[model samples]
Target: MVEQDSTFLLIIIALCLIFDYHAVLLPSAYNQTAISQENETRAESIEGTLIPSEVERFNMSSMDQDYIEDEMNYPPIRECSILEEFKECGTACEETCDDLRQLIICSQECVPGCFCKAGYTRETKGGCCIPTALCPLIKRSTVCGPNEEYRQCGTACPRTCNGIPEDCTQKCVDGCFCKEGFVLDLDKCIPESSCRVTEVCRENEVYRKCGSPCQEICGVQKETACTGCIEGCFCKLGYVTEEKAGICVKPEDCIPPKYVKCPGNETFTYCGSCEGSCQNQMVSCPTECGSPRCECLARNNYVRDKFGACIHISDCISK
Candidate 1:
């Protein structure tokens, strides 16, 4: 009986030890699971702090948002009436008198329509816009006599009447008058003939004959020269007239007449007169006036003399 009691006590001690060991192991496993869950929750909170919220993503200021909202509600722009097609009015005339007339009519049709811009004006005939200050002058009939016409006073008419009418005014007038360079003679204009006649040469003296229609003196028939009316005193032979000094001088004292080059290397010194030769014969002046230029024929060349002239290649001077 004593041994049986001893064996039962030993079995009860071993079973208690095994139960305590299993209880300790179960608690350690539960602790590990709780620690892993806590670590996962902490990692999720760290990720949330790194990301930006919705308000920060747009990056727009408060004032910008208000402006955008206002723009959405704004009214649309209205079109200008001038941009629309024209609706013709029956009063519009096919032809207008002048710019002033057109402007009056156009203004009645549309307040600002067909108006010209600055520095531009409407043309009288076509009513087109043109550059500023280019309008044509308007003329009107004058009250002057049948032979006379109204002119723009001092602007168009002569300011002086050459002492014939000493009381002439500087204003516009309608009366009988003489043409330029003439004095009044009865009812017509005539050249002056009271020129002084002289035969002797004085210092810086030049001679000019009286103008045409001079009264004959001592039966010496007056002759007309190249210049009209040889009755006027003139420079003697070989002397040209000088207007400034009113005298005659050697040809060298006068400005030489302009000369031009002709074709075939010829120089044109005068018109209607030949100044050169090709083979001891007079070379004719070119037919063309003004410059009197002439060209050589295809088979010809120029030869120099007093003046140049075109000649056959066979006639050219051998160097």
Candidate 2:
């Protein structure tokens, strides 16, 4: 029994030692955890204060530098006083007119100048400003009519045929035109009898040029008023005349007009002939000459179709 009692006491003492050892280790672990937490808290506080201040200081310094650089680069502006008058000055124009000239300052010291008179522009062609209407017409080659009167190309010139006004649109060429009773044949003026009047007007046949006349015997009546005494032939609406063949054909049968190198930077495209209307797709040619010819109409790009009609890029897809 004594031996048993001694064994029990030893066991209890060993248990108590284990408990004391555990208790001692628990405080050390707790201190370590507290210390780590305190260090993390301190680090966070320092970062929050120091990092923001550093960034703020950097931004402030950059702004200051930029301000200093801008101040150094730009010159100080001086305010001019309204009352301060200089030695050099000129009389200001005080005229009130619709076509008034632009204000002119003779010198830096001068006050605001007077306005130009009505109908006058500020353009200085010679010495003084003049009315825009009074300005000389640009000296283009004068186109003379059958009456020896000046008329612009495409203008309807007056011609007396059978005591009636033959309304002829002038060509681009400038020279003395044919007389009243005569029509232009090729380059020369000739009598109407000398010109060939088509015996049978085609489906779209029409009279073109000065001396050209339509035979009354022909099935087609004159659709339009007689524009000229010339015997030049042209196709009517929706038909185009072949350039080389001089025969009226459908737009589908038209050969694409030959390209003529137009002078100057003026951009041109084929129009009027086999070329479809510059205005739209469905519109027909204005003249019988099916040959597409270069024409100046603003600026546009054109291509020929398989049917030989000149079409705008916006109207058709390019092959």
Candidate 3:
């Protein structure tokens, strides 16, 4: 009975080995052998023995278990995804809108896998491939007016009369830009020579191709401490700008800011000209350096009251 049982076990292992050698992956006709043929010589010698050694038996059992586990755990193969097709000889190089018009030399070697469909290219590197017509660079072509040229990818903030920004975040854009020797002015491309003529500088203002953004403004004096330059009309030397009015004036000519008014007689000032608090009535108090808010009325001969309102010097003294 023991000899018969051993023979039966050997037959079952041989059948498993034969099935493992001819196994195929699902959804495809590709052949993939599971076990190595080096073990075939060792398996052949075991057939002569009535009962195989424990090591030989363990090896056979492991080989059979590996084959069974592989078939049970094999993942289901899927068809091509959207905008992709199974090609027998797919190109190693991918197509994109940036280089779609350029010539590409692809290998004709067999590489059976999914690839982008006809008339479609990869949208971005390792991104969802989309239709060729939907590409923004394709649509932007020939959209420029005379003297202007279309760019597939260029600075969105083009060189204007004000000047191009140094730190331009929106650089990757496809649209009409001024051609060489041309500058954009009021949404129209004109000769570089006439760029300044279009941008007429006002009095006490000068047009700078590359000017500092930090300048003297009303109640705020500063020097250029910027990382980049700004192109536009800037206040000339010995001149300061009143930003709200969009005009330049001398430092002494800057009108005290009155755009903001407090309740009652109190007025707002960027450079607090008044230093009188409600508890301290100072009609002729010296202006101190600080972020002075609504406290007192400068040059109005008034002091702050307890209710945060400005009152005449005589009224506070009388109380």
State each model's CA lDDT, in order.
0.36, 0.39, 0.60
Local accuracy of candidate 1 as per-residue lDDT tens digits, 117-159: 4554433443344433333222112233333333333222332
Model 1 TM-score?
A: 0.19
Which lDDT tens digits does candidate 3 get at residues 115-221? 77888776555544466765553334344687887677778678876667544676476667889999887778898888545377898777776778787677773
Q: Pick out the ten consecutive residues of candidate 2 with the lowest summed lDDT.
A: 24-33
> Per-residue alpha-carbon lDDT of model 2 for 94-185, expressed as tens digits?
22212123344443345532233455433232123333443222112234444343222322343322222344444343235566566655
Compute each candidate's TM-score over C-alphas: 0.19, 0.21, 0.30
**Would you give me the overall lDDT of model 3?**
0.60
Could you tell me the lDDT of residue 273 within candidate 3?
Answer: 54
Residue 279, model 1: Cα distance from true site in angstroms: 3.1
**Candidates sorted by TM-score, best first:** 3, 2, 1
Clashes of each: 11, 18, 1
- In terms of lDDT, which candidate is stronger, 1 or 3? 3
Worst 10 residues of 3 by lDDT: 42-51
